[model samples]
Target: MDGLLLEILTAVGFGVLGAVLFSAIGLVSGTDETATIAPVTLLVVMLGAPPAAILTFWMAAAVSKHMTHAVPTALLGIPGDTLAIPLLQQATAMRNLGAPHIALRKMLAGAVISAFIAVPVAVLFAVILAPFGSYITAAAPWIFLIAAVLIAYFSAGRWSAVAGLVPFTLVIVALQAFTGTQDVKLAVSYFLGIAIGPLVAELFSAASPMEARRMNRSEYREMTLAPDVKGWGGYFPNPFRVLDRFQTRATAIAAAISSATFVFSPVAVTVIAGEAVGARVKHAYHRLTSVLAVRNGVTESTYIAEALIPLIAFGLPLSPVAAGPAAPLFNAPPRFTVDAASGEVNNLHNLLSVPEFLLYGLLAVALASLIAYPFAMNYARQAAVFVSRKISHEAIIGTFVGLVLVIGLWEGGLLAVFVILTVGLVGGLLYRVLGMNTGVQFMGYYAAVLSVPALMRLLT
Candidate 1:
């Protein structure tokens, strides 16, 4: 009993830490989840934190970030992250209408409600799917291939992305083979390279004479701070009261449905959920607000579901979120791994049972609700102003670059560093030229590692 109490307390401590840390990170615009969350979570895993603590930390961080990400989206008219992109249209519309605060509130409210709904629903789905875990693991290679093609086809690049996968996967296979010749194995390098691809591409473009004019900014980017209006008396207002009956219903329904669609891309599900809900509303203002609520709601729901379902059911990085931001949880090398040849696994899936997942999952959500939700609700305008004026985007990008360099060198010295550079440069360019996003790139990585070996064996 004492040991169990200590474990629970430790999980709570980690959950709080994740919530506080990511809440601040969320306020910084353009902080991609894959770049920020994956590395940090990997560090936690590698440090030998308990499995329950790791799960809680990740859940709290993801939930908290989704809540506060609305700050920049609604107030500054810039997306807070990739997932926050789906909320931009409605957010910008609301900003232009002089009701950005209301938009922010609606988004935050939707996120809180949706997160609570998504946890149990996603776990239930995972439970149902758990019986097929063995079958899924056996067919993991083919499933990853099909999922890769489907995800690519649904991406912004569509057919172009699908075609791009072939060469992208080939590049990874080629890199692995080259690295193998040197008796070195690389995984985190590939993930980091892909995660920061766009940043690398932009840096290279900045140095090119041909792109000098386009890269140059004439003046400082101007941003207007939206006025804060407190409608309620307390620090944390009821999310239910913040949203209308219809908006609450829409958010709940969207969240529940999106939780089950964990196999799909989170951004895609978010867009579809908002569109599905928005089409039903007649009033323009109501439609915009409802869509904002549903979209933000889906962001929380899809992220939780994508990460949890795959982790709980198949112990594989099957979903895009699992393959990208949550990749470390599934396969962080010697600490956590998904063996390609045997489909053998040793990770959070085996460490934490279903009941523990449920308990820690809800605990993380509750912690985020207590910390990030109210903090964003009460101090959004101030947070937005500080982030805009005080924060240096370049510094953030450089920090991540330095972190990647340290990790790459630590992993396999110069060989790994070069592999990271090679993958980053090529993947970054492909992302910039084609509409092939990081999600597609991640799927391509999976295909290279999982599907390629399976194919070779079948052919032999």
Candidate 2:
């Protein structure tokens, strides 16, 4: 009983920490989950955090980030993160209509409600899928290959991304082989490189003489601030009250459905869920608000489901969210790992039971609701104003890059740092040029790690 009580306290403490920290990070625009969350969680794991605390921390952070991310999306017309991108159109429309506050409230409300829905629904799905864990693990290589191709096809690049996968996978393979010759094995460097690829690519473009004119900005960018109108009386507004009955129903349905489709890209699921919900409403205003609610709700549900379902069921980094932001939870080596050759695993799946997953997952959501939800609800405008005017994008990028470099150096010294740079520059260019996004590239990394070995064995 004493042990259990301490466990609960630790989980709660970490949950609140994740919530408060990420809530602030979410206020700053363009903080990608993979780049920020993964490294921090990796540090937590490295520091020997209890499994329950780790789970709660990750869950709370993701939920809180999505909730507060709406501040930038709705108020400043800037996406707060990768998942926030899908919510931009409706948010921008709302801002133009002088109702950015409505958009912000609806997004926060939808996220809170959908997070609650997603936890139980995702766990249920995971329970149903758990029985197949061994079979799935046994066929991991082929599954990764197939999943990689499918995800590439589904990416914005379409056939181009699919074709791009071959070279991308080969580059990873070549890098690994070269590193193997020097007795250096690297994983996090590759992940970090891929996560920060876009930034690296942008910096490279800025330095190029040919792109000088395009990269140069003669004047400061201008933005119009929308007036805030408080719709509710208290610090905590009822999510259901913020959204009407039809909207609540649509968000719930979308959250449930997107939770089931956990293996798909979260962004893709978010966009599709919004389109499906938006198409049903007749009035343009109603459609826009409903879509905003559903899309933002999905931003929460999809991340929760994608991270939880794969972690709970198969213990593999199977989903895009799992492979990206949630990677450390599944495969932070020396602490957590999924062995490619033997299909052996030791990570969250072994540490936390299904019941623990559901319990801690809900706890994390509740913590986020109590902390990030209300904070964003009450201070969206202030947060947006501070982020847009005070925060420097370069500082954020440099901070993350420095953090990644430290980790890379810690893991494999100078070799790992170079590997990160190589992969980042190449992957970033591919992502910017061909629309082969991070999700597909992550799958390609898995293919290099899992499928290539299997194919080689078969050939031998």
Candidate 3:
């Protein structure tokens, strides 16, 4: 009785705390989930929070951040985060139509509904996959290689993205060889590299005179504000009432599909889900709103599902989100560890059970719904105006830069920083010009570690 009470109390307390913190963070345009989320989650683990509390905190953070992330996407006509990219067209269209507020509401409503649906479904799916955990981990090397190509193909780069996997994998392999000589093995460095890659690439381009001239903006970007619209008369509105039968159904279906395919990039899954919905709806306005709702909701569902399913089922960083933003949950060493040689699972998978994940996962959505949903629904415009007018993109990037430096320095000192910079430069440039997203690059990192050696041995 006492133990159950403690767990419930812990869930509520931390869930609310995470919602508050992340909701604000999400409003900041151009914030990437991995750079912000992974480091903060690491802090939670390092501080010795209970595994259940930590899980709730992290899940709530993802949910809330994605919800508020719609603010910048809808109002500012910029991606709220990496996952917000797909919704850009839909969001911008709504913004032009003077319905940015409506876009924000539908986006949050879909998030709330799909998030609730995704939790139990993801937990059940994870439990179903749990017995095969050993086999999955054993096949991880090949799985990563296949996942790399598949994700790259689905990305905007198409065949070129798929083909680029070879050199990208080779780059990771070369870096690993160098780091091995220094007696350091790294994981987060690759993630930070990929996460910050686009920024680094843009900065590098500024060194050339012609490129700098092309990059410079002559004046402040114009702002568009739709007339503020009220929802169906409440702080918290029903998803069903706000969203038509088709929109709600589409959101639910997409969330379920996305939950199962956790290995794919969240953005890719989002794009696929959005496209699927977009295909069925013909009317431009309805299609626009429904697609935006489903896509933004996907941002929540995919992140939640990817993080939960991997931690619960395989206990390995098998999915891109799992391997990146959610890595510490599985393999933060000293406190939590995954054995490289033996394939041992000793993280939240070992720490918490399936039932626990379900309960806390739902609790996370509840907390986020209570705080982030209504807050986003009510104050999205105000928040959007504040960020666009007040915050500078440079400041946001600098904060993440400082965080990358701190965590890298702590891990392997100067060597870790070098690895992060090297990967970030190459990965970022590839991403900018070639459309090789971080998701593919993360898989490339995994393949270099797991599959390259296997391929070599088979050849031998």
* Model 3 ranges with Cα > 4 A deviation: 1-4, 278-284
- Where's the lowest-lDDT run of ten residues in candidate 1? 224-233
TM-score of each: 0.97, 0.97, 0.90
The sequence of per-residue lDDT tens digits that candidate 2 reaches over residues 242-305 is 9999999999999999999988889989989998888889999999999999999999999999
**Candidate with the greatest lDDT versus the true structure:** 2
What TM-score does candidate 2 reach? 0.97
Regions of candidate 1 where Cα sits further than 4 Å from its true position:
none
122 Cα displacement, candidate 3 (Å): 1.2
User: Cα miss at 167, model 1 (Å)?
Assistant: 1.8
In model 3, how large is the Cα lDDT of residue 125? Answer: 90
The worst-scoring run of ten residues by lDDT in candidate 2 lies at 223-232
Ranking by lDDT: 2, 1, 3
lDDT of 2: 0.91
The sequence of per-residue lDDT tens digits that candidate 3 reaches over residues 1-460 is 9998998898788888889999999998777887678778887887798899899999999999999999888878888888898999998998888888778878988999999999988998998898898898887667667777887887778888888889988988898888899898777667677767777777778777879777988897786655666655777777777789999999999998889998777887898999999999999999999998899888888898899998999887788788678877986666887664446768999888888999899999999999999888888888888887788877877777787789789778889888888888888888878888777787787678677887887799
